[model samples]
Target: MRPKPVKPKGGQESVWDYPRPPKLEEVTKTIEVYFNGVLLVRSARTYRVLETSHPPVYYIPQDDVAMEYLVPSDRTTYCEWKGRGRYFSVQVGDRMEQDAAWYYSDPIGRFGPIKNYLAFYAHKMDKCLVDGEVVTPQPGNFYGGWITKDVVGPFKGVEGSFGW
Candidate 1:
């Protein structure tokens, strides 16, 4: 027998209501990264994409990320909302922050949760600005919420973290 389809809670719009980040409207823009005055990553073609239930994730081409500064970590976690996530680190001038970036390359039943979104550690990023606003960056070591001063959040990343 077929069960009833689950409906969106609170009569709210489901994640599918909006286009996913990678599939969102794209703009050929410039993105840059700096750590203690040293240019880490700077490039054009930076994309302002979405991660659905998560947040807007910036998808910079591989060329834009300083691979030299990124160290892969084995820390992995499941989102139930975004799928399994993998971690990475960034180093800058003798400073290293652990697990600063994360991505879910292959999400499960991806309706809108992060499928291929790459987010950096706002706290570790010495300087990260989007279209000229110095992004405030999100908090916590495992979540990826870009919470600038004005932009607030109870972002999906941290919604269920207390159990972890």
Candidate 2:
């Protein structure tokens, strides 16, 4: 017989809690993302930009992205804390990068706030902009931190990185 299913402790969430974005605000960051010398993603879709211990990630909505450049990707990643994260690819001029963008469709109620937004790997793109100023991606291959003119970071994915 199957073991009795463990239930979530009262008031405590299971490991399926995707980190929810902060409260929505009237954010007006002029954001841009590029790849293969092409501007693949550009928008002013920054709702709540935050610089966490990880990186400065701008949570953006579906309306903000030019979906013409996006297509469904077959890749998926699961974090014990974030549930399953789905992936997408930015298609532009015949160059395609797989699983470069990700989102959580079914996060625990605690992180239910960000059910529809997405984030991209800033490094995979050739360029990015915030507020009309070109934003430099943080130094790493796997992190999406937008290090612009003012923000700084002790960002992850940069420590002890070797040339890939």
Candidate 3:
């Protein structure tokens, strides 16, 4: 059964209202990721993917991320809207989160702007922030969308929400 969506208040956006195929929009606000007290990424220019039933996933440019901390992983996944994704393992000191980040080397025509950009799993990182506001990780293991204040939903990615 599909869960009823929560009513959005205070100018919030409902994930249920987002498009199925998803749309890419450039983010002008600051996007930051930190792990083990170290800054992994900080960028003013990023792109956000908004899809139905999911919070936005911000994709950071390769130049803005701490590339040394990311190691290429053999894992890969396919997204109907995007293309095949390549994974990356994040390492800070001795701690490592395998396949914690992903990027599409060659995206579909509509998602071409995000090609080669990286999006991290919020739960795997110590913290992720948008414009200084800490973000909540979207539930479940497979989806990597980040929840911020402006977005509202009974979002997908939680237990019992798989069919959404």
Candidate 4:
């Protein structure tokens, strides 16, 4: 069963208000990803994908990321809207996180802007920040959304949210 959507407060956005077909919008906020005490990426130019019942998933342009730390993995997954996604293993020093990032080399439909852009799994990283605010990873390991103070949700990927 779907949980009741939370009413957003001032300066907040309700995930319920997002669309079924996710929207990709350019974000000017500073997006940062860190792993093993190392900065993996930091950028003001990024895109965020917002969908109903989900927190925003921020994608950083390849140019802004530390590509050397991301080694391509053999795994792949499909998103109905975004097409096939290729995974990457993140390694910083001797520490490594497998399949910790993903990107679509050739996205479908309106998602072309995200091609070659990568989205990291916040839970696997030391920290992910948006505009300097630390983010909480979206519930469950399958989704890569990042939860922040400005977004409200009884979000998908939580227990009992599989059918949502």
Candidate 5:
């Protein structure tokens, strides 16, 4: 059963209104990510993938990220819309978050714009900020969507939403 979507308030967008195939949009907002007391990345040149029943997944350019802290992991996952994704474990000092980030080196179709851009799991980070507002991580371990005040949802990745 599909859950009812939350009604969007002023200046807000409902995830249900997002596209099925997903849309990749360039974002100019200041996106910042912090992990293990380290500023992982902060950039205005970022992209967000918007899909139905999910909060936007922000992708930061490789140039802006602290690549030294990200070690490639053997794990990989395939997305029907985005193609194959490779994982990265974040290691800062002795603290490591395994499979905490992912990216597509060669994206399929419309997702090519995000090639080599990294998307971090908000739940794995100390905090992720969009336009200065700290975001909440989307529910469940499998999806990495970032929920902010401006986005409303009965988001996917909840316990009963596997079929959404």
Candidate 6:
């Protein structure tokens, strides 16, 4: 059963109102990722994916990410709406996060803008920011959504909500 939708406050958007298949769109707001006391990514040119019961997932342009810190990983996954996905391990200084990032090299038409763009697991990073505001990672190890004040949710990926 679907959880009761949270009423949005102020300018906040309810995740329950997001579409099922998800919507991908360009975001001009700054997106940043920090780990191991180093700034790994900061970009205003990025894409965001919004889906039902989930927060937005920001995809940073490959050019904005520190590629030297990203080592390709053998792990792979699939998203029915986006197509194949591949994981990457991020290393900065002596610290490393395995399979902490992912991207789609060849996404379906609707998701084409995100091709080759990287999305990180916010919880795995020291900090992830959207529009200068710190983000809260969507609960659970499998989903990579980044929750911010602008979005409201009783989001999926929380304990006992796996079937959502």
Candidate 6 lDDT, tens digit per residue, 85-116? Answer: 99999999999999999999999988998999
* lDDT of each residue in 1-164, candidate 1, tens digit only: 22222245553333223344324435454556667666665656655444444345565555567778778899998866557888888777788878877777776653243444456766677887665567655444454545434332344444443532
The residue-by-residue lDDT of candidate 4 on 1-164, one tens digit each, is 77899999999999999999999999999999999999999999999999999999999999999999999899999999999999999999999999999999989999999998999999999999999999999999889999999999999999999899
Output the lDDT of residue 19, model 2. 28
Local lDDT at 17 for model 3: 91
Per lDDT, what order, best first? 4, 5, 3, 6, 2, 1
RMSD of each: 7.9, 11.2, 0.8, 0.6, 0.7, 0.7
Residue-by-residue lDDT tens digits, candidate 2, 2-91: 122224455432211212342234456676777777765556655543423343666567777777788889898775544688888988
Q: List the residue pairs that clash in candidate 1.
A: 21-50
What TM-score does structure 2 among the candidates reach? 0.68
Badly placed stretches (over 4 Å) of model 6 are none
Tell me each candidate's TM-score.
Answer: 0.61, 0.68, 0.97, 0.98, 0.98, 0.98
TM-score for model 5? 0.98
Model 6 C-alpha lDDT versus the unseen true structure: 0.93
Off by over 4 Å in 3: none
Best lDDT among the predictions, by candidate number: 4
lDDT of each: 0.57, 0.61, 0.93, 0.95, 0.95, 0.93
Q: After superposition, how far is residue 159 of candidate 2 from its true place, in Å?
A: 2.8
Better of 2 and 5 by TM-score: 5
- Model 3 whole-model lDDT (C-alpha atoms): 0.93
Count clashes in each candidate, considering only residues at least 3 apart in sequence or on different chains.
1, 2, 0, 0, 0, 0
